[model samples]
Target: MRVSIDSATCQGHGRCYDLAPDLFGEDEEGYAVLTELTADRDVPEGREGDARLAAANCPELAVLVHEQVRA
Candidate 1:
Protein backbone atom coordinates (compact mmCIF):
# COMPACT_ATOMS: atom_id res chain seq x y z
CA MET A 1 0.00 0.00 0.00
CA ARG A 2 0.98 3.59 -0.64
CA VAL A 3 0.03 6.60 1.42
CA SER A 4 -0.20 10.22 0.35
CA ILE A 5 -0.75 13.29 2.44
CA ASP A 6 -2.20 16.53 1.13
CA SER A 7 -0.40 19.35 2.87
CA ALA A 8 -2.96 21.95 1.88
CA THR A 9 -5.81 20.16 3.60
CA CYS A 10 -3.75 19.16 6.62
CA GLN A 11 -4.37 20.99 9.87
CA GLY A 12 -1.40 19.47 11.78
CA HIS A 13 -3.72 17.21 13.74
CA GLY A 14 -1.02 14.48 14.09
CA ARG A 15 -3.67 11.79 14.21
CA CYS A 16 -2.01 9.80 11.46
CA TYR A 17 1.34 9.78 13.15
CA ASP A 18 -0.24 8.88 16.42
CA LEU A 19 -1.99 5.94 14.86
CA ALA A 20 0.99 4.62 12.90
CA PRO A 21 4.27 6.23 13.73
CA ASP A 22 6.30 3.94 11.48
CA LEU A 23 4.13 4.66 8.50
CA PHE A 24 3.35 8.31 9.22
CA GLY A 25 5.23 11.20 10.70
CA GLU A 26 4.60 14.82 11.66
CA ASP A 27 6.41 17.92 10.55
CA GLU A 28 7.39 20.74 12.87
CA GLU A 29 3.93 22.19 12.51
CA GLY A 30 2.38 18.73 13.13
CA TYR A 31 1.11 18.12 9.61
CA ALA A 32 0.96 14.52 8.42
CA VAL A 33 3.96 13.23 6.50
CA LEU A 34 4.10 10.22 4.21
CA THR A 35 6.95 8.16 5.58
CA GLU A 36 7.12 5.73 2.73
CA LEU A 37 6.51 6.69 -0.88
CA THR A 38 7.15 3.23 -2.28
CA ALA A 39 7.06 -0.09 -0.51
CA ASP A 40 8.32 -3.46 -1.65
CA ARG A 41 6.19 -5.25 0.89
CA ASP A 42 2.74 -5.05 2.37
CA VAL A 43 1.75 -2.63 5.10
CA PRO A 44 3.47 -3.51 8.39
CA GLU A 45 2.16 -6.64 10.07
CA GLY A 46 -0.14 -4.91 12.55
CA ARG A 47 -0.59 -1.52 10.90
CA GLU A 48 -2.70 -2.26 7.85
CA GLY A 49 -6.10 -1.43 9.28
CA ASP A 50 -4.74 1.15 11.70
CA ALA A 51 -3.26 3.22 8.92
CA ARG A 52 -6.48 3.18 6.97
CA LEU A 53 -8.43 4.15 10.03
CA ALA A 54 -6.07 7.03 10.67
CA ALA A 55 -6.49 8.39 7.18
CA ALA A 56 -10.24 8.16 7.45
CA ASN A 57 -10.19 9.82 10.83
CA CYS A 58 -8.32 12.87 9.66
CA PRO A 59 -10.50 15.89 10.31
CA GLU A 60 -9.49 17.47 7.01
CA LEU A 61 -9.45 14.21 5.08
CA ALA A 62 -5.93 14.99 3.98
CA VAL A 63 -4.64 11.44 4.12
CA LEU A 64 -5.09 9.07 1.18
CA VAL A 65 -4.42 5.35 1.00
CA HIS A 66 -3.69 3.53 -2.25
CA GLU A 67 -3.12 -0.15 -2.81
CA GLN A 68 -0.25 -0.75 -5.22
CA VAL A 69 -0.64 -3.72 -7.50
CA ARG A 70 2.55 -5.29 -8.76
CA ALA A 71 2.83 -7.03 -12.10
Candidate 2:
Protein backbone atom coordinates (compact mmCIF):
# COMPACT_ATOMS: atom_id res chain seq x y z
CA MET A 1 0.00 0.00 0.00
CA ARG A 2 0.95 3.61 -0.48
CA VAL A 3 -0.19 6.84 1.12
CA SER A 4 -0.34 10.47 0.10
CA ILE A 5 -1.52 13.80 1.41
CA ASP A 6 -3.60 16.42 -0.36
CA SER A 7 -1.89 19.62 0.57
CA ALA A 8 -4.75 21.86 -0.49
CA THR A 9 -7.21 20.09 1.79
CA CYS A 10 -4.96 19.66 4.82
CA GLN A 11 -5.38 22.10 7.67
CA GLY A 12 -2.41 21.28 9.90
CA HIS A 13 -4.58 19.23 12.22
CA GLY A 14 -1.63 16.95 13.12
CA ARG A 15 -3.82 13.88 13.47
CA CYS A 16 -1.99 11.95 10.79
CA TYR A 17 1.31 12.23 12.58
CA ASP A 18 -0.30 11.79 15.96
CA LEU A 19 -2.01 8.58 14.90
CA ALA A 20 0.82 7.20 12.77
CA PRO A 21 4.11 8.83 13.47
CA ASP A 22 6.07 6.27 11.46
CA LEU A 23 3.99 6.96 8.40
CA PHE A 24 3.51 10.71 8.79
CA GLY A 25 5.04 13.87 10.19
CA GLU A 26 4.35 17.58 10.50
CA ASP A 27 5.80 20.33 8.38
CA GLU A 28 7.24 23.55 9.83
CA GLU A 29 3.81 25.07 9.66
CA GLY A 30 2.12 21.92 11.03
CA TYR A 31 0.90 20.43 7.76
CA ALA A 32 0.62 16.74 7.13
CA VAL A 33 3.70 15.24 5.56
CA LEU A 34 4.51 11.78 4.37
CA THR A 35 7.16 10.62 6.83
CA GLU A 36 7.83 7.23 5.26
CA LEU A 37 11.50 6.54 4.75
CA THR A 38 11.01 5.74 1.08
CA ALA A 39 10.50 8.42 -1.51
CA ASP A 40 7.66 6.43 -3.04
CA ARG A 41 5.64 6.71 0.17
CA ASP A 42 5.28 2.98 0.39
CA VAL A 43 3.91 1.54 3.58
CA PRO A 44 6.01 -1.10 5.29
CA GLU A 45 5.04 -4.73 4.83
CA GLY A 46 2.89 -4.89 7.93
CA ARG A 47 1.99 -1.25 8.38
CA GLU A 48 -0.87 -0.95 5.91
CA GLY A 49 -3.17 -0.47 8.86
CA ASP A 50 -1.15 2.49 10.04
CA ALA A 51 -1.64 4.15 6.68
CA ARG A 52 -5.35 3.47 6.77
CA LEU A 53 -5.59 4.70 10.32
CA ALA A 54 -3.95 7.97 9.46
CA ALA A 55 -6.22 8.46 6.46
CA ALA A 56 -9.27 7.63 8.52
CA ASN A 57 -8.35 9.99 11.32
CA CYS A 58 -7.60 12.99 9.15
CA PRO A 59 -10.29 15.60 9.80
CA GLU A 60 -9.86 17.19 6.41
CA LEU A 61 -9.81 13.83 4.67
CA ALA A 62 -6.57 14.74 3.04
CA VAL A 63 -4.67 11.57 3.76
CA LEU A 64 -5.14 9.02 1.02
CA VAL A 65 -4.30 5.32 1.08
CA HIS A 66 -3.83 3.56 -2.23
CA GLU A 67 -3.95 -0.19 -2.32
CA GLN A 68 -2.78 -2.23 -5.26
CA VAL A 69 -5.75 -3.15 -7.33
CA ARG A 70 -6.29 -6.85 -7.75
CA ALA A 71 -6.32 -8.16 -11.27
Q: Which candidate is the best by TM-score?
A: 2
Model 1, span 1-30: residue lDDT tens: 666788889999888888778777887877
lDDT of 2 at 5: 91
TM-score of 2: 0.89
Off by over 4 Å in 1: 36-46, 69-71
- For each candidate, what is the lDDT? 0.74, 0.84
The sequence of per-residue lDDT tens digits that candidate 2 reaches over residues 1-71 is: 87789999999999988988877888899998876452487887788888888889889999988897647
Which residue pairs does candidate 2 place in steric collision? none
* Collision count for each candidate, in order: 0, 0
Candidate 1 collision pairs: none
- After TM-score superposition, the amount by which residue 37's alpha carbon in candidate 1 deviates from its true location, in angstroms, is 8.2
Candidate 2 error regions (>4 Å): 36-38
